[model samples]
Target: MLSGAAAQDSAASATGATPVAGTAASALIGVSVDPSAVPDSTAGAESSGSARRELVSATGSATQPGGDAATATAAVVDGSGASAASAGAAVGARHSASTVGGDSVIPPDSHDTVVILLPEMPAMDAPGALEAAAEFFANPTWLPDLAGVRDCWLVTVGGEQVTSGDPVPHQFHGAVTAGFRCLGMESLGVSFRRVDLAAGQADASRAAALVRAVHVKNEPELALRDGAVYAKRLEIDAVQRGPARDADLAHVVIVGGTGTLGVEFCAHYARSGAGRITLLSRSGETAEVTRRLRPIRALGDTPIIVESCDVTDADAVVELAERQEIPATVLVHAGVNYVRAELAEVTPEKFREMAGSKIYGTEHMLHTWPRTPDCRIVLCSSAAATFGGRGQILYATVNRMLDVLARRLRAAGVDAVAVQWGLWDLEGPLHAVGTGPVQAAGVTPMRAADALAVGFTDHADHSGAENRLVAAADWSDVQALMVAIGQGPLLDDVVAAAAESAVVQPDSPGSGHRDGNSPRIAGTPADGHRGTADSAAYPSGPDRVRATVAQGGTKAMTQFRAAAGQPGAAGGNSANLAERVRRQLGRVMGADADALDPSVPLVALGLDSLQALDFRKRVQVELDRDLPVAAILGGASLDDVVRLMAGSQA
Candidate 1:
């Protein structure tokens, strides 16, 4: 509990900014002000009645010294002392900085903006220091001189905090990012650089180097080595390796073996030479279980045991473990019940149903087995646990507990890791809805085997981190992908922040950067799959889709001709064209062509922003004519779309 004054003083000495007006400039974890408010040192000072405001709106929760709530607002003024909107609507969403434990923005008339930096410390102290540093940054400061200056802050945190392969760290980062973005949207000219301290503690010199990077508008995660700071780049080595001849897996126990991810895990281990896999779940006989077992059966004579066991029942789990003759070498917990509802709509019963398998199930297994150092326990968590997918509050909460459990088990010397995974390819409920929705959020579905391969690597590498988060796309793309996937209104501010951060780090290499002519898709057969050479590779998701479309020109034309039929031969009549357009639209809508009304807007028929983009692309290909998006989504009926298509051809 360091006092606000002492921390501000430490920051002032470190940054060399004058500690003017007491602690007014102390709580500046971040601040934004119009530069014009502060007079130039070379020019004579001009007094403007107006004052600059905080980077974000203040909650006015923190009271003033005299018992009144402080108002947070800034008056804009030009050189002539007249009020104006200095930086107009460009400011992002205005939120109370006070909510983040930071003070309100200085009264419109104050001057000075101070940027606080985290102090150099060892790996253990880094998390605490980071929390302290953010508090130090919370001191409110308003400087006319700083009104125009924009800057970035680099906060180095624990590698375990990030790479523990869990959603907890991701969730922490997501919330902090959301707050910082609100500041940026307020035109505070502030940005963030989070350096993962995976390598270890950094010295002052290295910290200074990071500052220099931020000053240059390059916000990269930095690490210290040999007394020098180096940028930590994010890379995905997705090149599939050859299956192990002597796989470490033998007797594998898969919880929820009938579920999508669980079956994939079994298949992966089966290919890796597993002799026996016991599938534990409430129900053993399921069509999904039967279908997914085909690939596993093809790999070898491995016997798959489907046992009826409810993981949530501790007594059942204990009894089942006692009856098992072979101790499980690898344990895969992939059981989860899906639930989607708004916070208010979610009842406690529904929450318990989702939490039973994720939280209670893991608890039961760990209690039943205790600590077996040789056994590698893998928990399949979700990306939604971090990003908190739309209408999935309970899911995120329970999944987060999995990451915490991993840490606790790791602390006790158990070999366990929780993986925060993106959507899986052609699996479960998502498979029924199609992959477009998840891909729209910028996540490429990792083929089931590929994801499990990463899990095996995690268990083997013992990266020392208990949690690891893996995704197919760069982290930056996630926000946009979420928007495209239909979380636009929910994540509008988040998307804006992500886009600005992208602008700040133009030179940083992204995970999704094309390696060559083709983008690599996760889980596609790599060099080792099917005994093929490593050379045969294909990209996944949109990149894969793009490549297929590029090579389908002749095929597209053939399909178009078949679709056109007699109407196409009748010189493109408007009525015939409208009928054809209706059919095409119906196909995209996943509806019956005859059931769709010709005069209804596509938007009303469930055409979202991402769906609209696809609709446009499909119409362009099928009709051989490009139609304006407005004519499709903006109250445009089927007949209207047809007219537009016909006019383009003419």
Candidate 2:
């Protein structure tokens, strides 16, 4: 953090205000200045107009790298032009104070350096606070009024200064061009006092008032909670500006088109109103996957090309590329593995089982996918890539490889990303994904359907930079709502929001929002506001933002552990029982056994969002004890749902 006087100096300079020119700033620890030099607290500065009397108000605290709280002092110019000392703001961020203080004065001929005082600090241990504070210094802004900075300092005291603000983060800052990384730190919290705001005798209050606009008056200044979960500064800021409302509905190709995650993505992009779509798979499953995509297929002539191409075969991939059409975008998820071994115990075969998908397949996709000027490449990574686990070397290594992969793509001038997927609920097909069983853990897993929706949005908006998308369970609901939008004026607000952000929309080939069953105009206008109905407007990547599909806060896609009352999925005759249950459900929804797609919106029919709310009631009437909502939602298919129907099946 820069000194208060230094802050005022730099900020004023950024605004093009001429510096008082001739006086130097100073820093002194804990010494009360002479009464003549300090500004009187009773006086106040008025607003732009009116009978106002408030130059500025102060609150918040300053923190060192890791300690809880530390005190810092700034010398503000007094009313008589001498500098005075003052306290900082609330919420733990330090700032200058000149509102009640006088202008700062200095002996033009004397060599007096403003001695800003930082008293002793207390210990603090907020998990990401150091990273946040580091980001703040790297780029300090207050609300809508922060200025660009050139250089600044983060000083720690020695001896008495050392005893008080002990163990300050002593990263270098005196000369210039020094690089100090703030990946993780040990200290935080500091208290600051104005040492001296001496710009040719500018009054302390006047100097403090210079930075009044930097403080937050309306919105609450949020800080990352001290934990593993808090988001990075860039991510937190990006999330607040909101998600992009407009998207390209033009053409795109998703290579791993049949896997649960891949197909789900195809459906979302199709639903998001893309023009032409080419869905590919290793086998001949694309046709069936496309057939199940009714909402997207309804978009008309949107060709869902199902082709067989082995991703691991370089020649086959090259041949596939030769026949492939260049899409505005390409998403490759051809690499997926079934490895589930402890790192120490994992064998070459087990490693190959996992490697065959991510590495070889992705390499093939990179070589084969037809490139376009507007095309973007998405490399799906995992949360485990950033944070490793005991039995997840295969999974974690594959995820991390994306970072290097994205960088290489960037160096090649192609839009690329390594999206780290959080554990999704339906990752049952994936070997490394299972996180024990869900019932024992209260983790909220993401559905493959939801994960795909978020992934597609990432695909459409990726700017080619190295990105990591962290999918939280909340993102599932939010992105699901985004993908559910039917076109026309209803999407006008979305487009407008996108335009405001200077982002572009894809050229969609289909007419949107033809929901004939609703009473609302085919595509009704939203309350037509931005900000609300928003969760997807943020950017798509961050090293810390781990792509949160269904896993993250919930459990990994580990194998399902059967409850005491139910038999294990593999050992029991659950398949036959599940099929019978599915048939019953199909009858309830007025559809054939095969009509339902695992990921489509149930709201399309008579079911409302509240449909899930009724599961507990169903459990009581049909199966006895109340079952969790996830129990019903996580069921592989509606046909064989176990939680509510388990008792009946038994």
Candidate 3:
């Protein structure tokens, strides 16, 4: 790694005025500063001295006995904690690969004060370089010169091994990482620095742009995520009456354009004055069903195109994108088949038929055509993905896959969103429209045209929601009509109302929970799902998706089955053997009967290996326990199987 060293003393300028031989700085390097000692933020948490220490010219400049100019600055804000925890990293957490070969990554920290390191930039850029240096000082860490200090350092890295290697041709930008180089020719021989921003979607994008600017300006090669690759456009969303002209306000597309959720999205975009809109479907006629949309065609000719396109045709999709300059800004995969069938009785053909339009369809869309960088994808998933509707296993599995596509696309510079939509009015699609299940569920299913119009046009409020569930069919209407836009005028109230009714149990054990590996409720919760406490709402809250047929996708791949069947690692956890059986029966059956002991016989708790295996999988998803899949399936009684799965890992 290229490194830099320099001697400049301004550390005390911002805190201790001028250090007296008797006074010491609060935190030498952060670990032990008593917060109460110092009154100001600079003096930091606190110190153990009487006289106020002031800044002094304390830097010692070292000329390179040789050379390396990678300036490294490390600053930390220490919180009062146990000595063991404060001194260094947590004991076991810093292992190079707790999960095996991957490098140890640091979790986001609250006490991370900014640290700025400036190297003696090469000459010739003069004005720009000085400006860069001044801006770089914005770091909260360093005590600034204006706050009172003197000249800085002309230093070079010391005490490091030197390597002699081949000389290569000069590129426009300096080497970004070891193997990569920034191809920008103008960035060579310049200086740069990175900055932090408020923690939110808007600000994060801004910060990313700032860092990218420096890399591009300096013509230096940068680490992948550290540069332009992370660009995220923030559009104006005309519905919002803000001065900002963000990129998010650009064009957006809805796939299942005629469905309940699809229309709502349209309304939001229309109300927000999204610059343009497109509703994609298997047929163009589906787009012409709504009357209010006739005016949308003119909106000063904003171009709300209704195109006939089969999602399954990957080649045609690529053609559609190449034909349009703006690209499909937001594509939702809401087109799905909601079939009901028990796990034991379902036929393979039925699974294929229902899922073909979405699974194979979406795969064709993403893999064959891919998406534009600025586009945002919204795939409509279902609660069944989490609730495990016995008859809808195949359907749920397909939906679960969509929810997770976001992370997979993130690294590639695209965003994917899988939203678990509640069932629309029965008549809306799958179930017969007027059915009791649809009626009791209280869902207002918009017609195919209404769904497309609403989802494509509305720019309603997003605040006050806890789980991103949208219930008020009011916005559904507004969306279809392209009426009442703004940063959601009565947004909070509406969101609060919708949230109150939608939540199952705001305080239940499974409510408002989050797991890093699971996308069931991931990303920046949707505009409707304001991530907050779902208090006083339905007490049960949506049943924890954790108890579903699937939650962790790659974590429980089919390969795990083959791995266990192969050899030694297959032995089940001994501690789990007894305890699991009791829990499985009690939990799965919703049996509040009595306190069952782990030692109880399989018959007593309700045995059967098939059920046991199913129970074990649910256990792993709900609680991060790993039980051999076979342990419960191979004739092991409930108690025996539970014992195997419930080992200490449970």
> How well does candidate 1 match the true structure in TM-score terms?
0.46
Q: Over 4 Å off in model 3, which ranges?
A: 1-247, 286-292, 295-301, 368-371, 411-413, 433-435, 438-650
Rank by lDDT, highest first: 1, 2, 3
| Model 2 misplaced regions, further than 4 Å | 1-250, 286-291, 325-328, 431-433, 437-442, 447-466, 473-650
lDDT of 2 at 517: 16
lDDT of 1: 0.41
Clash totals, every prediction: 30, 103, 77
Q: Residue-wise lDDT of candidate 3 within 361-437, one digit each (tens)?
A: 67666654434666666666654442222245445545544443432343245655444444454344566422333
Worst 10 residues of 3 by lDDT: 7-16
How much does candidate 2 score in TM-score? 0.38
Ranking by TM-score: 1, 2, 3
CA RMSD of each candidate after superposition: 18.8, 23.9, 24.0
Distance (Å) between predicted and true CA of 176, model 2?
33
Model 2, span 218-303: residue lDDT tens: 11111111110000011110111112345444667666677766766666666555677776677755445556666556766666
lDDT against true structure, model 2: 0.33
Question: Model 1, poorest ten-residue lDDT window?
Answer: 6-15
Query: What C-alpha lDDT do the candidate models reach, one value each?
Result: 0.41, 0.33, 0.32
State how far residue 429 of model 1 sits from its true place (Å): 3.4
